[model samples]
Target: MTEAKRIPKRSEMDPKYMWDLTPIFESDDEWEKAFQEVKAYITQCQALQGTLGDSAESLLKGLRLQDQVNMKLLKVYVYAHLKKDEDSTNAKYVAYNDRASSLANDIQNALSFVVPEILSIEEDTITQFLQENEDLTLYRHALDEINRQREHVLSASEESIIARAGEVTSAPSNIFSMINNADMKFPRIKDENGEEQELTHGRYVHFMENNSRRVRQDAFEAMYDTYKKQKNTLAATLNASVKKNIFYSRVRRYPSALEASVQKDNVPSKVYEQLIQAIHEYLPVFHRYVALRKKVLELDEHHMYDIYVPLVQEVNMKYSFEEAKDLVLSSLTPLGEEYRDIVNKGYESGWIDVYENEGKRSGAYSSGTYGTPPYILLNYQDNLDNVYTLTHEMGHSLHSYYSRREQPFVYSNYTIFVAEVASTLNEALLTDHLLKTTEDKKRKMYILNHYLDSFRGTVFRQAMFAEFEKIIHEKVERGEALTPDSLSELYYDLNVKYFGPDMKVDEDIALEWARIPHFYYNFYVYKYATGFSAATALSKQILEQGQPAVDRYLQFLKGGSSKYPIDLLKQAGVDMTSPDPVRQALQVFEQTLDEFEALVLDK
Candidate 1:
């Protein structure tokens, strides 16, 4: 009997691989000290609430104070949440996260008067103040953003009441996070060696990509079965989350949750709608790719689990963490030496948590705030997918790196609409590098297959999610309750529509929504699709046009929230307002598919 492989406990991880948090806080004791001090600042923020409309100096003082408190608050919250994500089972850090969350709500409530107070001031008065005070000019854009939402801004008391409920409103996402990361259990499945192995969120992808059909099917059933058991509870959590979106949308006077969400980034609802409409037009392109996967794999009937395995599986393209870093650095050469050096610095510095451990969060992200290194968290597996993930996350961290260096703290964070652009652009560059460098037909096919898979996952799949979010929100707005069966039915139907009739859409795949954390993100998944489209266009420019294109892209990264996301992308040379980018990306996918099929038929 083979002993099942166990996840390493946090205490057992190598010290060099773990991120160094001392840059943010010297120790837990220091974090504690900062926590108390920020609590004091939160109270101080409340003192300036009534003074914003008094005079220009008073308004500037209140605004500056708000930035000071928020910067401090973000630093504290980032540290706590990162610590919590390291190992959610650790009670101490969990408490730290909870406390930080509560303090965040307190800070929001304390400063809630700022927006309404600003709105209360006559627009001509604000114009005069900006003209009179050079310091106030710094916040002209920020004030303009506030003024743009004048109809949405409630009275100060009402705004404060809503802000105080932040924690309560956030409860659904928090509960789902705990359940998905900490409490849920997956059944053991036999690996390729026929030895029993425990399934995890991090390991599930590797399992699906396993060469053995039995392994893939077993892991698929085990993964979905686990979620199936808690379907009702998961449905309730999702229902609560959707309701929360609706509640806030109505309170803020938005027409719907989708508008409320896109409004933050100043994106038109048509952008979201256009993505779905474009993908629908390109469904045949995706269906053709699905048919190719079926024919190449030589499967009599293809299941959802069958899609992830490479078409050229005979070539073992597995890579180590060091090798992945080397590949990523080499691939990003088009961006120049300065960009490459920053990636190398991130590697040498304590900017990334490089591997998975027991109780660690699944998936990957780049996270940080002003006055901190943009840190990346990855539950790395030694595969080509993880290599793409490395470059993707590095893209995000580097975006943060440039933004923080160039913009003021008030404009530091980019909108979520443009957030995925930097990340997916790296994935495109990596694919281009591998295809250009690899001489062997098999290796090239594998890279091509992976690129297409990236498209399938990022564009087709996420657009499906975007549609799901839209449908569910609309349904709930019409007073329809989202039951477990209804959610599963709707999800299954979407799968059928997207994947086409060539593949067998398994019943278990219906429960996949139960496992996705992005649905909790409130219309967030569509950006992955839109961003990938924008990135595909930009990657072409960078590759074909050279240094000039790179200059424009780097500038876009540095712009942050100083300009709207659409405007920033316009500066970067991609006009996302049109459907051309999506259609252009699909053309690339089809051209690649044509080449892959030629290789197959010639063989």
Candidate 2:
């Protein structure tokens, strides 16, 4: 292959494989026009601020205009973000993204008066207005949700101060991102073939999944050794991020930082606590799975570095991006014709940026706006994981497509709370299809192992992180200091508890906390645990309950933020309030484990 062909520039790639942003904005000129329009809309919203309490018509008009401006802003922001992500090196797109973000803060500050002003009006008056102004009924639920947070709603100045503080508060994350992605470097390590491979953030995970113990260890140690040198810096950055959380929580009058964080999607504190509690009960099962890995790998003792390399590496399933598209679309047929057509269109219609290029974002995500087709950015690697990622992201894209097409702009977009369910459900379906079609016992065993590992990582492992976050926050809340040594000790103890005494917990594993960006996100990891449980239940229902379940799942895809996330999942037949789904998901994991052990052991 030509050197240029192996790694092509964004401009070198065919436009057919890239996402069509023109649907949202015909050109940069048009986008620039919309950008100016965003400023005009902000001024327009600001004009209606003080007059909101004057009449029902005024309130209704302002809310509708708010929706319009938000949608326009979303279009601008999503476009800029997608463009920036496509090629992070592009200064034009980066500036557009930065400008769009500033515009958001301006809009937020300008419209800060709307909520507090509406809250200033009597509840009965607002209700009567909604009753009198039939048009205002469109925003009735949205208004009610805002009204319900009256206790937390501060003055306009206070809200604007908080809004503006976002830029400053975001510094820790920004610093961490720059340091982790840009400044940090890892030394070259020998691959499984004994070839020296220079380690990058992107290659570290891949290196750990190598079949050779030496490669995994070298990669792990080399990665962490670098982190170890900067442990104090990372800990300080994390502490600042945590303090930012505490600041907002305290300012917003939330009882705790965790509450303030999950409150974004109206998730209850109990859901977060319940996830940790349930996972604590199942840690033994995860440890046993770890033991199973050690036995299968035929290792006398396996360290933390050995955890990632699959037990059954005999099945090397590599699908090109094109083949993965076909696999994803075929696997999703259970979702019915409508959803399948959307996936097919996405595959054919350049809705995805399918391959990696210089300066593109490293991870995968489905992003878009209320009116436009959702776009996915992926660094496709052609491995089994990449195939699952294709399905996962397509799951998100289809969810956005159905939701935006079916619901009004006001309720079109879903929250992150329910986002993971759609993504993970795709993986579940893809796993089912792969396992059912693959007759080879080893591949079947590998697929089963994949499912189990997914459950362990997503449900149990995230829950463990959630628990750690909770503990640390509580400590901070209680006037405790967070230093590198202190955080490491806490993290190491958690690992010991979670992984059990069977596996050797290496010293470098404690530094793993420093590497995780999610720790900076307060009380967010539990959602993945809960999302996995919900997705597991929904995927099972679709496979077994057939059309009826598919019908409900389709409803969920279209519901968006029309309802609270938990209620939406409840509509899809999973009650996240109870730990039933978590247990049910664990039961599935146990069953998969049993099958894999039976097959591999010839039992």
Top TM-score model: 1
lDDT of each: 0.93, 0.84
TM-score of predicted structure 1: 0.99
| Residue-level lDDT tens digits of model 2 in 1-603 | 112223357898778678888899999999899999989876687678688888899998888888888989989889988887787668788789788888888888888888888888998888889889888898887887897688889997788788787767878976786567546766877777666767766566677778888888898889999999999999999999988999888988999998888888888778887777778887777788888888888889979998878878767777887788888888988988978887888877778987776566667789988888889988777677778888888888888998898888888989889988999999999999998888887788778887887887788778878888988898899999999999999999999999997789999999888988888767778888888889999999999999999999999999989898889999999998887888888888888888888887893
Runs with alpha carbons beyond 4 Å of true place in candidate 2? 1-16
TM-score of each: 0.99, 0.95
* Model 2 clashing-pair count: 0
Candidate 1 Cα errors over 4 Å, as ranges: none
Q: Which ten residues in a row have the lowest lDDT in candidate 2?
A: 1-10
For candidate 1, what is the lDDT? 0.93
Which window of 10 residues has the lowest lDDT sum in candidate 1? 42-51
lDDT over C-alpha atoms for residue 283 of model 1: 93
lDDT of 1 by residue, 318-388 (tens): 99999999999999999999999999999998999988898899999999999999999999999999999
